[model samples]
Target: MESITEEQLIQMVRDFIESESSAPQISVSSSESHIDSDHHHQPSNIDTLEEMIWRETTDVEVEILEKILMYMRNMGSLIIEPKNLKKWVVLRLKMDGYEASLCKTTWVSFPGRAKGNYEFVDVITNGTRVIIDMEFRSQFELARPTQSYTKLIEALPSFFIGTEEKLGNVVTLLCSAAKESLKESGLHIPPWRKATYMLPKWFSENCKKVSFSPNSNSTIEEF
Candidate 1:
């Protein structure tokens, strides 16, 4: 697996947004909510579990969710996605507190071709159920951020049914852990096509993380 520092990942996201600012090729629309009791996955052991995948959302993904909590206090809403194909975040969007990096489901398999099985997955969040769209990836696939997000949003809803509880209700970027695997296997990943323009100075090289403005000075979270 190729090792990538967090900075490289953030640049990929900035580059993605810039590309979309130049032109719009997105064929996206709001998805319908398929909330059915039969479709929802409620676990029998949920009451017994102490540490849950849902709580991991805030702890694992961003380093300073606590500080982000303070910042969100004033704001009524937020929009976030993992950078560089990494994590998924689910927050209460309430009481000025947030939680992310929630895990919905995980699947393990082979790497790519002959397509025998080369696929392992941990679907932390399904955006459709949550009613949002976001994708995270690294600089290598930096070109088509919008396109990728669009596709994930479209496909996630159908699977909402039949999952264990605590796993459902999320759609975060889960590509980080796999970025190295894909590169090591020499898979030809398409550069995210949506981004066409250069990014702002905040994302210039020699950067560590971007402190989200108007928020408590970047908080070392989601830089």
Candidate 2:
């Protein structure tokens, strides 16, 4: 079996997404899809071949893929592997027309009864203070992740919305302002991709300029 290169994998995804059919059939290398020997679990029922390709993959993984493509056309690739029965995907970003692995992004699931399971910083990009918080649960979720982020904003004076207008609660302040915290933060990100994509991209691009750093209380998970 010829080893599949990172470039080939990236082109596969691009081709899959661009295909005219709603669902396209693409062959994946067994090594790429192979699970660990210790792993013992039934594969979840998949509605599409795309989902089967990344069976253990999550919606978040697809989001990260889309964001990487945003910066470059066919230069990025993703490799999905299992870690302790959980699927982890490593992103290879395009550098000088080639793909290079950054680091393995982990997936942390929580018990439903556990408090604050869904609310925390998911992962941080290597060699940068670009923190991607795993909040964005509905504005009505019981956890209220946005409220948690308010502490980050209050702790650092340098943090501000990505738009030109001043920031505040939309209900009480500047309802008519052209710019808004939610809009600027990409909260209303199109249904086509992850809501958190724009935020990370913004932080990655402005980490140095804004001097953005989360406080000690911020729940940052490092793998």
Best by lDDT: 2
Tens-place lDDT per residue, model 2, 1-223, is 3433446445544543453134334456887577768885443222232233233234544455465445334323532321210111222222222222222232222332111112112233332222222122122122222443443222221211111111112111212111233455556523212223222222222222211132233211221
TM-score to native of every candidate shown: 0.23, 0.19
Ten-residue stretch with the least lDDT total in model 1: 193-202
CA error at residue 213 for candidate 2, angstroms: 17
List the global CA lDDT of all models.
0.28, 0.29
Residue 211 Cα positional deviation in candidate 2, in Å, after optimal superposition = 21
Measured over all alpha carbons after superposition, the RMSD of each candidate to the real structure, in angstroms, is 17.0, 20.8
Relative to the true structure, candidate 1 reaches a TM of 0.23
Instruction: Pick the TM-score winner.
Output: 1
Total clashing pairs for each candidate = 29, 0
Off by over 4 Å in 1: 24-96, 106-223
